[model samples]
Target: MDRRKSLKIIGGSAIGIAGLVLADWKWQLADQLTHKGFFTFNEENLISSIVDTFIPEGLPPKVPSPDAKPLGGLSTGTDKFLYRLFEHCYEKETQDIVKTQLVNLDERSKSEFGKPFYRLPQGDREKLLISFENSEIEDEVNFFKLMKSQTIMGFTTVKEVMENYRGYKVAPGYFKGCVDMPSQA
Candidate 1:
């Protein structure tokens, strides 16, 4: 081939290789930033739904919350909690354990319920969770406990849960020790 043609071919190959590298790097970076390497889009989505099951939306028209407002999984920052938990709090090994446990849960849900865990009927989902909690497998029991406690902690800590769900108001901290003495005088 001529020099110009050879140059063109080399240029095209270099461009193609560079594009692939850029694309791969972009994908990896996005994955890590999204879930700190513990989850992909689907996995993150599944975890969100899983958290929802644990603390579903308590809204009106069917079954209302005590205050007739929505206060549950979405309000509790369940998705954000999981993302932060795996991203900043947990080690990679713990994250991997959580991921594997969730994967196994989904697979079991698929096999037994004919759908993934998120798609299971509410009753079935609750039953499955209870079974896991009572399971003889030490690891399964531990995973259940961890999931429940983290989710509960996350749910309870959010402002929505504190103010709306629990009906707690911010109290002003003040001391009026001398007011009664002044009145008596």
Candidate 2:
């Protein structure tokens, strides 16, 4: 299949969860993610690296990666992109899910590879995520579901992917109300 087709498939299919909480209007809490007190840079970088792993900057199988821009993934700011979604969009219980998932992933990586998730080689990182995606382990399953959804959401917003793959119009004309025109007698 073509690159755009692949992007659509990936974006549409990754959101495997039933009731995702994505609030477009309530983005104010996103600012808190960048704070040092509540959120450290180390955490953000780790999350970002995981996002990058989910969709890496390389040719897939036999398909050539886009030469113009990095097709999708962390180059689009997905590393810290889910901060708002977790902090604001998700309910308290769901927020706990996010935290628990990240921590579990870090621990798993260290236990398996003797290094942090971000420090692993790309192949190993992908293998770990793939294992989680297919694993029956409760925490792994939960993290995969959440990360896949958020990563796909962030991937589609990357400028190149939005325009080239999804056809997002950055400068579309203004919206006007559909008013009934006076009927001709």
Candidate 3:
């Protein structure tokens, strides 16, 4: 083959390979997210929303939101991310426990609080959340500690949480040792 023709063929083949690699990577990611072992999208969204709200979304003066940008309110997407991460970290049974407990808690919230767990007014919501925070739910099929820990973990790990609450980044690429961190520090 002529040198120019050979170069063109080689370049084209390289581009094709790159494309395949990218496509495969994306497919794997989607598959992982769409078909987690324990948590379904609905369950995750439900839990994440509760967690975010339980934590609340706001940036203090000179700080930013912890997990995402402060776009007037919270992002449901961050909850999903945290849910996925939690699912990956724990066993299937463990995740199921958390899910079941969350559902139970929602039911309890309805009966005890007289409102949907997520729909209660701010003060009532805060009081209900305080109850959850103070005591772990007991069950043969649930892990209340895991549920509570995961909620806190998901929110606190988010960059927006640090930025908003403490004016910090959860995972800054470079560390600035000299900055005197505040409450979150």
Candidate 4:
């Protein structure tokens, strides 16, 4: 073939290859974004159990009030909140760390108590979490702290907790002016 024809054919082939690679990359990226939020069904259940342990249901009122009904983490959808938070807000490294730690927690529970974390008794679950909190491994300790803080944050921010447990009024019905201010003592 002549030089010009040969060069033209080579350049066209290169462009075609480049276009195919780019299209493939785009499709892969779209697939990842679409599937990103999903965790295995077992993982979801495990997270729910962990959050419930952090704030178990049917806590007694501190002041023995008949009207009080303490809200628990799972009851408030804290586990679902945590899942979204991790998927959307956390960095990829942090998300991976959390997933890894969750698996590790289950493995540790199985080895220690002969059951997965979600199947362990409440007391055993608490004991396992306490061990994580006191663990010398930095990842384990960090995971415990992160889970505890996130669980509490999610539980406290629920609408039921705000209205019932905290007596949080969105708007005060009356705002009395301090007309009769006490004299400076």
Candidate whose lDDT is highest: 4
lDDT of 2 at 28: 35
Worst 10 residues of 2 by lDDT: 16-25
After TM-score superposition, what is the CA distance of residue 68 in candidate 3 from its true location, in Å? 12
lDDT of 1 by residue, 79-109 (tens): 7777778778988777777888888788888
Candidates, ranked, TM-score: 4, 1, 2, 3
Q: Could you give candidate 4's per-residue lDDT for residues 1-185 as a string of tens digits?
A: 59999999999999999999999999977765565545765677789999989899886456236776666787788999998998899998888889999999999988998998999889999999999999999999999999999989998889888776678888969788867977897
Best by TM-score: 4
**Candidate 3 structure, TM-score to reference:** 0.51
TM-score of each: 0.65, 0.63, 0.51, 0.69
- For candidate 1, the 10 contiguous residues with the lowest summed lDDT are 59-68
Clashes of each: 0, 1, 14, 0
Q: Which candidate do you rate higher for TM-score, 3 or 4?
A: 4
Q: Can you write out model 3's per-residue Cα lDDT over 53-79, one digit (the tens) per residue?
A: 655665435433345444212452556
lDDT of 2: 0.72
lDDT of 1 at 5: 94
Candidate 4's TM-score: 0.69
The whole-model C-alpha lDDT of candidate 1 against the native structure comes to 0.78
